[model samples]
Target chain A: MKIVLIGSGNIATHMGKAFMHTGHQIVQVYSRTLANAQALAKLLNSTGTDSLEAVVDHADLYLLAVSDAVIPEVAAQLPQELEGLVVHASGATHIDVLDKFRHAGVIYPIQTFSKSVDLELTETPFAVEAREPADTSTLITFMSAISNRVFEGSSEQRMAMHLAAVFANNFSNALFQVAYDLLAQHDLPFDLIRPIILQTAEKVQNNEPRAVQTGPASRNDQNTINKHLQFISSNPDWQSIYQKISDLIVKRKENNSEN
Target chain B: MKIVLIGSGNIATHMGKAFMHTGHQIVQVYSRTLANAQALAKLLNSTGTDSLEAVVDHADLYLLAVSDAVIPEVAAQLPQELEGLVVHASGATHIDVLDKFRHAGVIYPIQTFSKSVDLELTETPFAVEAREPADTSTLITFMSAISNRVFEGSSEQRMAMHLAAVFANNFSNALFQVAYDLLAQHDLPFDLIRPIILQTAEKVQNNEPRAVQTGPASRNDQNTINKHLQFISSNPDWQSIYQKISDLIVKRKENNSEN
Candidate 1:
């Protein structure tokens, strides 16, 4: 099926490339910048269009892979009599936001993406929703062409997933920053933590993370905990974070024991 | 080299097996329990002993792979006229604690170890230190046989690495627990987040995690943030964690912009 991707940002760049590799025609690429649109369009062998009106061309799906703030306004700009099924790839934005389109749906990929990222289809989770059963099926089938796992989730469920992604990906990445800062302050090379970080991630795939949790906080090793607390005492923000997360871990372990 | 392993725990079991696989003689396996010692000892065709005195036979190295608190007393129990090098594998414990022995060193593997985890050689980093230069060389050579990467890190550096490992491994795993809890509370399978978790981990291996940060907190998507905060408000601990981590991300972004 011919697909028109309506954004030339990170997600669109990677997703469009993945789709192209799978032998799907990316019909057109639209972005606020003609240069970006043309660049991605050229890569996909598709036409470039900065104007939303220009996206009325031939395509089976129009992926509104734009920012969350612009999803509704972008939908309003599309033709009232649409030529194809329209979908936006926003995770937090609701399904109803796409209701203005004659045929509308969502294809939210739940993964952290960037242009430099070389992604495989199996690594991406496509969370889709649609106004009608056939529309949903159509979107799922089209998505399954390039990806094996496609999930049917409600807008509310998708929102929950979006929040959870923050905890698992974005927030977890920030914690990496915290670790970097703490080590840097001690004049330690950030590279020393790299191997352990990779191993930590690998461990979860084989076992539950909680059962594998080991540290001053996990062991309730007060001596090391006190030392770390004193080490980070200068930074009140990190200190509070350390204290709260530690308390939470202990509380959760206690709760689990009760069960 | 003949190695006498003390404590038949996770690290001991794993390292013992690695040594046995490398065709090194594991002279003895000592633990609190005869059965546990026998089980691991049999794998390497070595004697299992509950009595530490009886097990301190003719070996080139005595590797004390035991709990952090037990190292000192264990070292004290050893006879003064020893004929082998002595070392403890506790990351947080000081190498000077083994000063009672004429020849003492450390062989601290920087990766998390479990008896069940089959570690790839190139992936593990070994941090070694010793009072004498020859001792360090012997330990480094022994470790290099089992691992590809070996670095000379002082006990201080290893302790710092151990602390950093807590943030990288334990804290990250705890965040995973939070992700699991948030999903489980909403009647979603913890499995749904597995792929996302794996991808998040993979991204950081070759790239800076700070560079790939995303989601509502990173974007400062106030609407979505407000909605998630509302949803998690009932769980006050999670609510605090969510708020603090969000604030940290936003603050860090601001800090990066200034620099």
Candidate 2:
């Protein structure tokens, strides 16, 4: 498949590499910053450009790997009459945002990407959506070349999945930052809790997270919760988060018991 | 080393197996319930008892692997003039809780444990605390036999570590539960987000979590955050948590920039 990658950020870099790995041709790379596009295009052996008019119109797919807020604007600037599939790689954005194209779809990779970390894309699940049944098949085939895990879902389902990712990946990492700051305040190394973080993630792979949930909040251990609240009393932000999450966990546990 | 494990719960079960793995003899396992004690003791080829009077007096170490609330009562019931070192496996409970003993310390493993999952103890960091310097060496040697990661800290330091673990492990898992519940509501498989969770944790293994943090919250993308809030508006608990955490993240990023 011939591809034109839009946006020269983490997702574009990773996706371009994955497409190249699967023997697909990346014909052009686009970024508002010409240098950024050039850097990625050089690696992919493709043309680099900052202007939307320069996007190759004849590619098999135009993968808009841009930020969510920029998707609509980027989609508006694409060649309106282009005879290629236009897909945005965003979990939060709806497929209709690219409705201007004859062939519009989504190929949202349900994984976090960082430029510094090399990820195994084969196992990363890609949620695919398309306006036409034929385009869906084409998108699935394109995704299958890079990943084994692909699912067909509507925009609503994709939004739900994105929301869940926010909690699972985004919010959870925020909690890790909280942990890191807490440890650093006491002159402790983040290394002390790294094993536990990995183990916690490992447990959720097979078991239902709710079933294996172990903590002061899950147990409704008020003494420990109070102690933690007291410990973080000076930091009202953490105190509220600590209290709110604990209350939520305890309530969930209670609901589980009643059911 | 001769050891007596005084608890038959999750920590005791896992710790007993680890102690036996390192060639330390578990002389006895004690629990309020004889069946629970027997269940763990039978696996380690040790005696199981419910009565505190039956605890072996000659063991080299009496390991109190009990709950934080029960530690004081459990310690009170032990043989007062015992010759061996006494250590509690708790993060929140201070080492001073066992000050009645001539040789007192702590052997708090910083990893979350479940009986269903087998963990490689060699990499699990054990936080050791001792009343005397000689006992610290003894505790270190014993811990070294089971794990390469051992550190000495005072009670205050250990409590701080425990608080961090709650954020890193427990609260992080709670966030996973939130994700799981959200997906289940939409009839989506939890498998979709599992890869991201693993990758998020894998990144933290070598990188500072604060440096590698990514998400709407971390990015301060209020557009996506507002969209997420609207998506979850029906659930008040999640809404409050979402708002509080997003605000906190934005505030934190601002703080980071100032520094």
Candidate 3:
């Protein structure tokens, strides 16, 4: 398949590099910034263009690898009625945003990416969705060719999965930031908690998170909870966040008990 | 070292099993429930006794592996100071809780344990602390025999580490429950987000989480935030949790930028 990347962000850079080992051909790259476009284009030995009108219609797939808000605007400005499928690599945006194109689909790679750090994308799950059934199958097949964990889901599921990832990955990462910051204030190394953090993540790999919940919150130990709360009293926002999460755990425990 | 575990819960059971291969001898196992005590004692080929009066003074280490609230009560009932060190395997409890004894210390295993799963105890981090410097050294040496990751910390640092862990492990586990339940409502499998969760944890192993934060909240993208909140509006508590955590990320980002 021939491909054209429409943005030079993390997703675009990763996908461009991943396609390097595959049978696909990357023909053109486009970005609002020419240098960003040229940087990724140089990796694929492809042409770079800052003008949306200059996007080539020669590729089999043109990925709108841009932000969610501008996906519609970018799709609107692209050359109309292209011969290839037009897909966006967004977890939140709907496929109808590209309705002007005869071919519309989505291929959301469900993992964090940084250009400096190469990824084992072959193991990353790609959520593929399309407006038409045949288009969905085509995207699934292409994704399967490069990765082992490819699944076809509804646009709603893809969005829900994204939301869940926010809690599972993004929000949890924020909590980690809280831990890191608190430890730093105490003059303790983040390395002190690394092993325990690894074990916490490893636990959920085979067990349900609710079943394996631990700590003062899960145990409903008010003494420890209050102790922890008092310890962080100086940070009112952190105390609130602590209380909310702890309450969620306690409430869920009660719900399970009633059932 | 000669050892006796005072409680037959997850901590006692895991530590009892971990000590079986070492040079240490578990002289006795004590539990409020006779059967529970005998069950763990049977694993170590040691005796099980329910009465504190029957506890032998032959062991060099007495581990009060029980709950935070009952630590004082349990410590009060234990046989009066012999020639052994009395320590509690609690993350939140202070070492002075055993003030009635000659030797008081803490050996906190900073990992969640389930009776059904066997762990690689050697890799687990044990935070050793004590009321006296000599006792602290003893704990550091004993813990080092069973695990490679052992460090001596002040009681305050241990308590702070426990508080940090509430945010790192316990609160994050609660967040994972939120994600799991949300996905179940959408008829999505938890497996879909497993890789992302693992990657989220792995990134922080080498990088500060604040530096690698990602998500709509980190981006301060109100559009997607409003969309997610609307989708989960039926559950007010979840909506609140979502708002608080997202606000936290946005605020932290603002702080870093200001710095």
| lDDT string, candidate 1, A47-83, tens digits | 8989998775567788888888788888888877777
Q: TM-score of each model's B chain?
A: 0.93, 0.97, 0.96
- How do the predictions measure up, each by TM-score? 0.91, 0.98, 0.97
Return whichever of 1 and 2 wins on TM-score: 2
| Best candidate according to DockQ | 2
Model 1 regions more than 4 Å off? A57-59, A182-191, B53-57, B76-81
List lDDT for all candidates, in order.
0.81, 0.90, 0.87
DockQ-best of 1 and 3: 3
Candidate 1 has an lDDT of 0.81
Q: Quickly count the clashes in candidate 2.
A: 0
**What is the CA-based DockQ of model 3?**
0.79
- Among incorrect, acceptable, medium and high, the docking class of model 1 is medium
In angstroms, the error of model 3 at A163 is: 0.5
Q: Give lDDT tens digits, candidate 2, residues A192-249.
A: 8999999999999999988788878887889888988888899999999988888888
Residue A221 displacement in candidate 2 (angstroms): 1.2
